[model samples]
Target: MSRSTPRPEPFVSATSAAALNDLRTRLRATRWPDSPADAGWSLGVDVGYLHELVDYWADEFDWAAQESALSRHPRFRVEIGDLNIHFVHARAVSPVGPALPLVLSHGWPDSFWRYSKVVSLLTDPGAHGADPADAFDVIVPDMPGYGYSDRPTGPPLNSIDVAGLWAELMRILGYSRYGAAGGDIGSAVSRYLALDNPESVVAVHRMDAGLPVFTGDRADLSPQEQEFLDSSAAWGSTEGAYAAMHRTKPQTAAVGLTDSPAGLAAWIVEKLRGWTDCDGVIERSFSKDEILTNITLYWLTGTIGSSMRMYNANGSIPSEQHARRVEVPSGFSFFSGDLFARPPRAWLDRVANVVRIKELPRGGHFAPFVEPELYAQELRDFFRPYRKALG
Candidate 1:
């Protein structure tokens, strides 16, 4: 079979002046929600803190600077199947050996912006004092319906469908074989890429093992594994409410999120603070500009609704995909501050061909962006052994 050549076109994100003005107006006119006496983040986003953030977003945050910085990367759009995928195709600048191609997928509440911190570090390791041989030609894509990519107007696309698109994307980019890495929903996408196209994906690395992929009898799992499952359920009871809303009633929530910048920030920033190792201070993990930049992307692109719809699509993935064991070599990194507890080796072994597992001293769910140096080094070490396969 002949591979299709991709017609790549340069892509840049530019929010209209009117849109910026409207966002400011909405932020200024935000309907304030009253907080219970002494209420902090326990009852969702703290109204006090949110008001402060809204003030910064309205009067001080710089969207144009962030947009310009984002456009500095070599971004491009390529048509694949029914969607036009937007991706950053950065090549190794001073290679010492093979510049292995690596595709990185981003999760929700984020776009390709999730990988902006680590792209250059991975692509040119020598500049960062690492072995130039560790360099990778990084490819970070904004999955369909997120960021600059076309949103699904028909049936929502799941991780499986996006994985298929990613496989074809790599093929179209002239990579017959490559490595895959990601976190959050991205972790699931990388797993699906390995499951659905193992021949082409040499190895895969993820921050989380994703929703537990199990098969056979429950009797097979160790007691600790069972406890982990129980803890997951408990976590879901509290942390999972938003997911349920996304799965069942995204449109209801999307209406407010899409219409009001403050509403969107309130929804997304809570997760950012809760899921990160910020010790209850969001500014510890992200600057006001950084936080607002991400929120503003959702606001400007009008993608909050489409992004939420992905949960509905994911909920419908066939049981067989959940049960399918990933045969490709897999690696896992458990960042200490991540929202979900790290799965035991026994649990991960049930789903993937586990080759490496490491627990970092710091970082949380958004590790790639929060701790790019550590995250990039982890990728370099894990994929080091697989580089020969690309030869």
Candidate 2:
């Protein structure tokens, strides 16, 4: 913990054999529901679909594959402010030049696994086309109370607090100057990183620049923005039930997620089903093992409770921070497939430098895993100019 800026420790623990056992038992005891005969995903997380998923998770799922992959990265923890962060510091493939340090953060329901594809691609961009000088020493941290950082303490942590932790983590990793990128909740935290440590964050990138952090009222909205705003409002009302629960009664719902493996699958599978490029069952997009492994991390680490703390924290965007213009150099990837892909140029312009924007023919919110090649290329291309600037 930084003596100057000590917060409280959130994620800390020795992984228990008992926790893993409890998860398996929960999976074994899952009481399944029956599906409507003609029903499709319209009902969300189809019942029959879930049964097939649960069986595979119970029998064939390889949790070790993901666990070992994550373990090989020299995982370590640091007491920063109040959070004990779990992170992987993978060195860049630049034998000659400055290894551009980069912290790739993930959003809700996604562990560091979301950025797994981009890590090697960014750190070894010479293989992809960009110069080695542009390569970044990637530090992908499981945000406090999220993945492995489960044992949170104190009131609740907010985006700015997370941003501060990122700053401290970057410094702890000896990254005085580094680039940052994220999507979903990751995007919000990255924005705060830029906002909090404008001097330290050399460049900031986000998948959802259209969330309109500080943009003003409806009077400030144009006709086009007005329509998008209306659609956003509708989506907020209908699709944001998950956010509502997290914001208000996270502890209440953490009960089921912390208990049942199948229950956690139902929660996360809904996102993979609802948010990914796949139109039908999750298998169409992700293997049952992949889906199960991600959820299992939450179960094994008991992160469900701490991760939900994000909801209770950070009430609404701060008045000054909201609609507040970001001065740092910024870039945006218009992964229009994601939940927050707002395309209005004005909406995006408010918070980003936006040197490059691409409209992918395919992909969705989980673009890193959903469309690795395209997403990797987007990262390489957007940071190309900065690579040149660096040299």
Candidate 3:
């Protein structure tokens, strides 16, 4: 470890009994909202489902079990710059040779929890019926304001700033070169990692190219590119109010979310249902426990405000940053139900040194969590050739 970077101490996820009691108290006392007849998710989070979910959350959901499950992975907290970052650092087991170091960045409505299932599969591939040579030393960090990590006091760190922090974190851990992968804000962070620290980041992978932004002439774009841009705008108008709140008035929205567990659950669960490949049945994609565990983390941390503020910061990123083309080798996996999964190859080529692109038949925006085995296989396949080059 470098002398300049402080050593990381082992961390365990433990919530006090008092906090648990408070959560149940709030869940029990939730003032119910009324929805029109047969209003099943037509308006924000279906009230009927929210009631059932909240009932389970109050009486049935097990935080201790979830916390224990989270702690089973080797977790740590280290100070990088002014913030103390919480990350899961699971090293490869029984590698055939040198294992490639890989950092996995997570996006909003979730944290390190997003990559929890894939960690062991990635770290110990042979045990999971994969080649030992495909093992990776995995690092999953809670982007500064999420989960157990410390929230930034000043302006929320944008994707570019988070990318720099990730690079320094890898440096502190003694990884001279590593690969980066992420989705949502994580996608943007990984993109910046490849763009700004190409030498250190050997290659990069992203779930989506993010909402399209072009500063160049409209005539320069292909018809497909133009249509993709138009469709993205439509998505924003219909399904992006939550994002609009995050970017424009986070504190105003966060007040209710941070105070009420039901509000928090409604906010996060709506996305989980809308974004995952559950076909309108959230339980098909995530159990009540899985859903509540993620929501409870937000309630306990009280950092929902800070996490949303990241959008406001990112909204201010310069136009040139959005236009910059990445030279680093890049791969993408566009899952069937994700937001704009099949991004035009032309648009991808314009921004990245497109090496590979795969469109899986299933899964959604939260692919790693929704389909861990498939997601793990995608990483192994995409980075296998790059691993040979590293040697």
Candidate 4:
């Protein structure tokens, strides 16, 4: 496929500001449901959770504070594949240090907000007391339908296509070669960046990798393989409902999630509860404000339906299915979280030049936000070897 250069666009125009105001109105007008879960957000964002969050969001959460925080970084939009993609661009300041242009992508239920903590650590590491040589020019983007990006006008876009666009985006920013990192859907995008746009990306780092191909001539053999597979099967039976809906009937389900703040909160909160790394619940790892902020982004943008279009567009990309084998140099950090593919070393080595593999002491689906120290350190170490070339 031929690549297209992204045209210029700003982060937030008057349109987005107007939309935010409208969402507050919707939150105020919401009629809560009789929650199925208990008192808190565990069973889902309960009625009380939504009421409390919406109250704070309306009175105190301060959209203005969040907006000003985001505005500190250089924000811009680029027209890619007929869609405007919004991203934050911050160049590293150290002249003596390496400044590889790094594209960091956010996965589902997360906007660019998740990366805000690590941006300064990566780009302005000297100020944060890290080695200046570890600095990188950072570019964090909200996927097509998420955050401030324009809603998908018609058809769904694939993860690989997003990666190709990022390579093109970096070239526009004057980087001939670069590096990338991702988690969850972000990891999928990073894989595409290295695999499809091999000419531009130097190396790739993955915080999460999906279900791996279990190519075994014999079905019953090793204990470890059998064990992990059995656990994965159990997870599929219970927590895989979201995957099914997104895969088959996305648009049909958007009405309820969009109409009521309580409904939207519950729908989004379930994943936060089950998918996180915490022992008890998502609340253990994230605050009610933290959880609602993600939901608010989707509610305000009406991107919930559009975001899920990835599943519909690809229509059952069978779990463990390798759409295309990626041969790029790759570093992997596997967190102790549910639904993580746990790709065998042999399989990843075939599709990628497996340079680093780390087993983190803790973390889950939302790696960066859940365990920033562990996640960011893994990023630092994995990308350390390429510092001389890109940093």
Candidate 5:
């Protein structure tokens, strides 16, 4: 704890009764949108399903219970640079060795809520039947402009910027060395943490290499790399309209998402179903309560807009920055059901000094939430060897 760094105040997740009432009122008053006959989910979020989900949300969902569940872990908010960052700092319960400090970053359409299920699994692995020696003092932060954290008033902060903030955050917490892991936007931030602060970051783990950006001559690309770019392009044309909107005209879409609870649910829930390994049945992966809890966080915090703007900010990261390779020991996990086109080993090798690669049998883009036990074990296995370096 430095004199310059402000102290972190204990925080809890509690929405005002008035806000909850307004949400229910809006959910009940939602004007339904018509869909083509037997549309199902072919044309965006299924209307019939949305109707049922909204009905449940308005009449049966329990925000208080969800809030209580979220607050069960130790949470705090502290001013980090210009933003008031909120994070969960769960220390190792009973360590058999020096517990490794791990910072987990999350991506869009989700907040720290993404890792809630796995926090205890990581912090107290002994109770979960894992070796206490593998325990991690886990830190999961809500990215700026998301969740309970303060929204950015100026330009959006990109991954590089956020990585710097995380470094400072770890320093403030008295950690001289730590491990970094993330999925989606978090993967980029974790990569930059290793890139920007190589000495302090013990190891880096990322789920994907992000969309391919060929900074050099097309002639130089390997065949597999070229295929990845083509596949990513195809995925974008079909499945990335929401991201395009987030990058270009987020404010326009945010207007509706911010105001209408149904619209917000529809926009986010669609991704939840499409991205997870649910095999077309969303409930197979997430119950209605789980789905609504995430959506309700976005609605209550009014952060959907700011969260979207992050895409816009990231668009401006220099091409050179995107092309930079990380020399720090890096690990990659490509879950079987994630973003259809898994990055080729050649691509991963080109981007970072890859040491470990795991083709997980199950799970999808939201691996932590979808398979907490599996995800926890993956982290424990990957970071176990690195713990010796912590000494």
Candidate 6:
């Protein structure tokens, strides 16, 4: 590694035998809740489904295999400021041209696991029957208080702060310039990275435009944009309760989530099912192993509370950030099954110098994981024009 690139210590994800035993013990001891005779998922996580999942987790799901699978990638840890961030850094094997350095940020209730499926596809597109010129030196980092990264002991770090850390991380990796991409909270972080460091970020791509960043005159919005905002409000009225809890009373809610492994699964699996193209069945998008692996990471790391507390920190971002327009080149992919309605291209143009926008026929919020090939293709195509700068 170059002297400018901080030496990344090799890391592995390991769960002790005792920890596994304890988890099984917890599962065995779980006191399942009752539901009405016909209650399916309308109330929340279907009780019958939860029972089936919990049984699989306790009896069939293999943590050892999942851990080994995650460790198959070159995982590393480096201290960025006060937090020791964990990330997967996979370099292109063979490139038809210069491999663009790309950083992928993940959203809530997930970690680097969100990008694990796409890392190799991004790094070696030729193996997947695409042009080797599309390869990227992919870096997928676990945000502070998420995954194996250090949880905040003090005030939580907001998206802008996290964006600054990401910029520094790319610099530490010996890349003075790079592309950024993500969805959900990661979308917000990528937006800030473009806004705060337009000079260094070659371009940015996101699955969503993020919360309305425009605070300007209402007259600027097209009728479609107005309708989108109105529908967003309507969606929030029903589907936004979890965010409100995260923003306001995360600690109180964390107590139960931390104590009950099943409770943790209940909270997260609902989002996975609701936000994906999985219809009402989560397994359509994520296997039992995949779901358990994610939930287990949170359970073993004991970072769910710290992760939720980030919402509290985000609520205090300066109003200017919301008002600022991102000058860096931007791309967006609106997957049809996503929970949030696709924003009109007019609305996206309002906040970003959008160079590309595509509405995919399928996929959802967790596109990288659920639709890795399509997601990787979007990144490769969107960032192709900017690869010359990295040379």
Best by lDDT: 5
lDDT of 6 by residue, 329-362 (tens): 9999999789887788888877889999999987
lDDT of each: 0.90, 0.73, 0.92, 0.73, 0.92, 0.90
Deviation from native of the Cα of residue 258 in model 3, angstroms: 0.6
lDDT of 3 at 106: 93
Alpha-carbon error at 122 in model 5, in Å?
Answer: 0.7
Q: Against the hidden reference, what TM-scores do the models get? A: 0.98, 0.90, 0.99, 0.87, 0.99, 0.97
Error of 4 at 325 (Å): 3.5
Q: How many backbone clashes does every candidate have?
A: 0, 12, 0, 3, 0, 0
Over 1-391, each residue of candidate 4 has an lDDT whose tens digit, in order, gives 1355445666653336677677677778877667664556544455675577677766666655555665777789977667777898988877355577789988876778778767777777678666677778889988887788877777777776677778777877778878899887888889878877787777899876664445554254355556656666676676777877887888877777777766777677777766766875567888766776677777767788888777676554444535366666789988876456575665566567888998876778777777776766777777777766653
Clash pairs detected, candidate 6:
none
lDDT for 268 in candidate 3 is: 91
Say which prediction, candidate 2 or candidate 4, comes out ahead on lDDT.
2
lDDT of 1 at 380: 97
Candidate 3 lDDT over residue span 323-371, tens digit each: 9999999999999888663569999999999999998988899999999
Give the per-residue lDDT of model 1 (tens digit) for 1-391.
2545668788987778898898889889988978898898989999889999999999998888999999767999998877899999999988988899999999978999888999999999999999999999999999888999999889889999999999998888889889999899999999999998989999999999775645557788898898888788788897999999999999999999998888999999999999999888989988888888888888898999999999999998877878777899999999978888678878888888999999998889888999999999999999999999988
The segments of candidate 6 whose C-alpha lies over 4 angstroms from its true place after superposition are: 1-6, 213-217
lDDT (Cα, 0-100) at 180 in candidate 3: 94
CA RMSD per model (angstroms):
1.5, 3.2, 0.9, 3.5, 0.9, 1.4
**Deviation of model 4 at 98, angstroms:** 2.9
Candidate 6: deviation at residue 182, Å? 0.6
Span of ten consecutive residues with least summed lDDT in model 5: 212-221
Please say which candidate is ahead in TM-score: 4 or 5. Answer: 5
